[model samples]
Target chain A: MFQTRLEETAAQVAAHLTHVLDGYPAHPVTDAMRYAVQGGKRLRAFLVMESAALHGVDPQQAMQAAAAVEALHAYSLVHDDLPCMDDDDLRRGLPTVHVKWDEATGVLVGDALQTLAFELLAAEQTHNNADVRVALVASLARASGAHGMVLGQAQDIAAETAGRPLTLEEITALQANKTGALICWSAEAGAVLGQADPTPLRTYATALGLAFQIADDILDVEGDAAKAGKRLQKDADAGKATFVSLLGLDGAKQRAKTLVLEAEAALSPYGDAAENLREAARFVISREN
Target chain B: MFQTRLEETAAQVAAHLTHVLDGYPAHPVTDAMRYAVQGGKRLRAFLVMESAALHGVDPQQAMQAAAAVEALHAYSLVHDDLPCMDDDDLRRGLPTVHVKWDEATGVLVGDALQTLAFELLAAEQTHNNADVRVALVASLARASGAHGMVLGQAQDIAAETAGRPLTLEEITALQANKTGALICWSAEAGAVLGQADPTPLRTYATALGLAFQIADDILDVEGDAAKAGKRLQKDADAGKATFVSLLGLDGAKQRAKTLVLEAEAALSPYGDAAENLREAARFVISREN
Candidate 1:
């Protein structure tokens, strides 16, 4: 039942994004923008809506925040697949923007998407106070920028072609900045839109973020390429550090289970109000892909 | 005399930025961040401060805005100078970030600095009103994003390698997005911080931004290589469109003078309240490097 609702919200968010992005001038850059944002798993947007629902926030209001987060996620993917980064040719079973266009267009499209995220958030009329918008902007900026995802990416690149192996703690820190930050921000920003105190939301989101990464690592190790929709075990081949590397398969699975439990525990204070979010947390770890 | 003050303010802003940025963790990414932002003409910073002075805004308050603009400008330059874009080796007499570090570091540093700009504005205690910070963030995002500078850059790259001569109007539109948008944003943001209505400020800044680009074109045509700090006449060599290409050298010079006049006229309503900004307009055309 939750999966069906998640798919519906994901489709709605993508449809809205398509409408907002379609109005750009018909330049190669604008075309690249469409290419980068037009398709995705929409996982981040789902997390935002589900978490917002947990706080009794209107799903419609949460949709704006969800779309913004998804835009940022798309922008990161566009840049990440560049020749200088992962150099991947495929994302979501489609040609990466850099492959479809050129590197320059890919870079610009990513940049535009990042800015578009802020523009969407800024245009939100549902939030009556400018303070709410400011906080949301700050949340998104930190999650997407250097002190967060960018920094994590830098560490990941640095870890590559280096002689030394990264410690377990270092690996966790890197993932926390790169992947965990945005995941956490999506939930926290949704709570902000719900007018909930951000402290508990952040705490809940952090555990969920770790669980998300562990699940991703597990998928890369055991999931089929057709099911995952992209290359699997690329991280292992690249010598990129992961929980699977440090914890082994059984230990990693145990750790992921522990994280999901802790994430659910963090939402206990909200009781039945957070039922959707709790269910989402369970699905995050249990999904095959 | 005004040149001396501009230099002094640039130095002060640079010093403050250095101090603030040093507080980050000293990783390679952090070092790249420091290197990318450490030195520049600080033209945008100067414009912000000068515009604030014209409006009788406090110098100290103006400096905050100036620093924020400089950070954004520096971030753009770092990204612009990457192997994927202009591929320049030198900036302000030092090796560019990509040359000094790697391309990934360059990319990450640019992302970090861009975030730092908003973080600086958001953390400013002087800007007590949340609405003001929100406006600043929104304006910066719009100017820097796909619809603005990034889009401009995408078009510039596409046009440059397309092997066709672009029309005069097309070239101007490109420059308006690439160079003019950020320059106008700098001046208008200053005016906004000074609590002045931005409509007139934007009008003045837009004219000045175009004028500034024309001056840059003229310099590229006739300026000395040593003084200009980079290659000269490369635009013509690369077959890149410019005002000088569309309008012959004499015609371009005449258009530049006309633009300066129009820019000055935009500020006329403010009378003496816009003296410093008006002087800066004259200074732009007269600058040798």
Candidate 2:
């Protein structure tokens, strides 16, 4: 049931994105923008949709917010892959934006995609209430800005230059800010739209986000580069600290499992209706990619 | 009056920025963000404030929008100066963000700053009506995204790589989308806040934006590096087609003057109360640096 629903949500979000990106004047940056946003797992989209559904928010209205998070996620990946940052050549088995085009195009595409995220969220159709739209915009800005993902990026960069690996607590905080911020936003978005208490979803996302990062660390250490669609073991190569390094592989696996349990527990208030969300939490720690 | 008001506006915007930036964790990227945003002429900020004033919006409310535009502008400049882009070492007499910090910091700061711009505008203090805030966010996104400044930037880069100069009409259109989009947004912002018809301010900004770009072109030809505080004449040196290249130096000056006149004329709807805006148009054409 979860798999079918997740796949359905991804398709719907992708179609909506195609519609939104339609009619861009065919320049390389525009082309690159489209290309960069094309393929992501859309886990964020599924989270948004599932959470919104759990809260009785119309999925039609939820799709835009879903697309917005995916777009924002795509922008982060594009920028993260730039030579000045991670310097990866491939994303999802294809050339990264800078690799396919030029560094300039990568920068502009990421910038433009970020702008498009806000644009989508601010559209009136996304929500009937203006306050809701504004809330989405403001919260998203906080989630993605200097205080959020960018801050985490800065911390990661600073850690690299400091000639030392971070402690376990530091890595946890870093990942929480970096990957977890957007995940929290994605999970909480439906409640934001529905004007319900975000506490449960927020709790679910906290554990889910941390579990997701641990899974990535596990994948980096043991997963195939082809499956991951980018370089693997980059943290080890850069002498960076990660859950797999701080906690033993087995220990990391155990911790991720525990997080999944916590995430599942957070959804108990929604009863069996949140079955997909519980499945999602389990999937985070278990997915190879 | 215009000079004092502009200075006052810059100071107020600066102070507000300082407050917004107050609690950021002391880090290189945060420090670089402050440095990069500092010391620009604040022309866009002034425009936002003055236009909001024209609509009788509260100065306190108006300052956030002003700061938002300036933050957005700062982000544009930072990314534009990267090695893959314009690669300038200096900006406003200080080392560019990349030079002062590192390429990673430059990219992150710009990304964060752009996020901060939307965050500031979406703040409840920035407007009373949620719809007004949403309008500001949407308009800004359009102005700054693939359709607007980024499109213009991509065109400029493509023109350089094409190994041929753009025609006069092409450059005009490019500049309109690039500089004019943001300028138009800044000018029309007050009208958006006031819920007034933005026709006249839109017209005023169209001419002002073109005149500003023309002045930039003129400065590229004749302004001193010392006063300009960045490399000058790079356009002429690269054989890039500019207003001065398309029109003779005298013709470029004449064209800028005409634009100033047109810009001033568009302010007639506001009568003598728009004297500062008129002077702004004149200043665009006449300022040396």
Candidate 3:
């Protein structure tokens, strides 16, 4: 049931992105933007839809925010894959935007994609309450900007040049900002829309985000390259410290499982309405990818 | 009077940006972001402030939006100067961000600055009314994203690879999107905040924007590099068609002067209250850089 619902949310998000993107003028940047956003797992979108359902917010309304998060995530990936950054050629089983198109297109497409995320949140169709729309934009900007995801990325880059391995605690902090911030925002979005206190969802998302990162670290070490749909073991190749490197593989696995349990417990306030989110937490650690 | 007011607006906007950016956690990316936004003409900021004042909006309330446009413009400049893009080495008489730091820092700084722009507009302090704040975000997104500034940039790139000079009409349309959209947005912002129709300012801005670009083209043809604070004549060297190239130097100057008149005439609705804006229109074509 969880798998079915997740896939459904993913499809809806993809369709919404296509429909929204279609309204823009045709340009190569637009094409590159479309290409870059095409194939993410849509876990963020799933979190958004499921959380909104739990809050009784209309799925269509939630879809706007869902697509916005996915768009923002896609922008980050496209930029991180640039030759000057991660320099990856493959992503989601396809050529990176910089590889398929040119670097300029890659840069512009990523930029335009980021702008599109805020555009989606600010539109009237996203929410009838202008206050909710502004809140969404503000929260997203905080999560993705200098204070959050970008800070993590800069720390990662700084760590690379420091000529020393990151400590376990340092890696955890870095990962929390790099990937966990957006994930937490996704889980808390429905509450923002519903005008409810988001403390519990925030707690739920915090654990879930950490578990998801630990799982990613585990995947880098042990997961199949084809199934993961991109290059694998990059952290080890770069001699970077990861959860699986700082902790033993078994230790990392244990930690992720514990985090999942915490995530499940945090959702207890919602009971069955949040069962899907609980399943999502479990899926984060166990998925092959 | 216009020059003094423009400089005054520049100082205030810079100070506001500094105060806001200082609140973010310290990091290398934050350093790069601050460096990137340090200096510019601040014409867009002036437009936002001047238009807001015309609408009787409080200056402090308008400062947030003013700072936001400058941040967005700075981000565009940083990205445009990337090695993979225009490959510029100097801007505002200082080394470009990538030249001062590295390409990775350049990319991240630009991304974060763009996020900061939307964050400023979405802040509660920008306005007491949520609808106005959302309107600002939505309009800015439209101006800067795939449909507006990015569209113009993509078109410019396409023209380069197509091995043909753009016609006069094509260049005008392209410029309308490139430098024009944000300027128009800045001009209309006060009206948006004031809950007044923006048609007059839009007309004024459209004419003002074209004249500004024509002045840029004229400067590219025959302006002191020291005064311009950057390289000039690269457009002619690259054989790219510009206003000065398409319509001779004399013709371009005449067209810019004519557009200044149109821009001034658009402000007739406001009488003496709009004299500063009228002066701004004249300054657009007359400034050295």
Second chain alone, TM-score for each candidate: 0.95, 0.98, 0.99
lDDT by residue for model 3 over B188-247, one digit each (tens)?
999998899999999999999999999999999889999998999888898999999899
| Model 2 residue A33 distance off true place after TM-score fit, in angstroms | 0.7
lDDT of each residue in A167-271, candidate 3, tens digit only = 999998998899999999999999998888899999999999999999999999999999998999999999998898889999999999999999999988898
Candidate 1 vs candidate 2: which has greater TM-score? Answer: 2
Sorted into a CAPRI-style docking class, model 2 comes out as high
In Å, residue A224's CA in model 2 sits off its true spot by 1.5
Residue-level lDDT tens digits of model 1 in B131-250: 887788778887888778887887788787788888888888988999899889888876787788877778888888888898898999999877877778878888888889889889
Give every collision pair in model 2.
Answer: none
- Model 1 residue A51 lDDT score: 77
Give the Å error, residue B264, model 1.
Answer: 1.9
The regions of model 2 sitting more than 4 angstroms off are none
- Misplaced by over 4 Å in model 1 are B124-126
Instruction: After superposing candidate 3 on the true structure, give the runs of residues whose Cα lies further than 4 Å from its correct spot.
Output: none
Top of the candidates by TM-score = 3
Candidate 2 docking DockQ: 0.87
> Local error of candidate 2 at B48, Å?
1.1
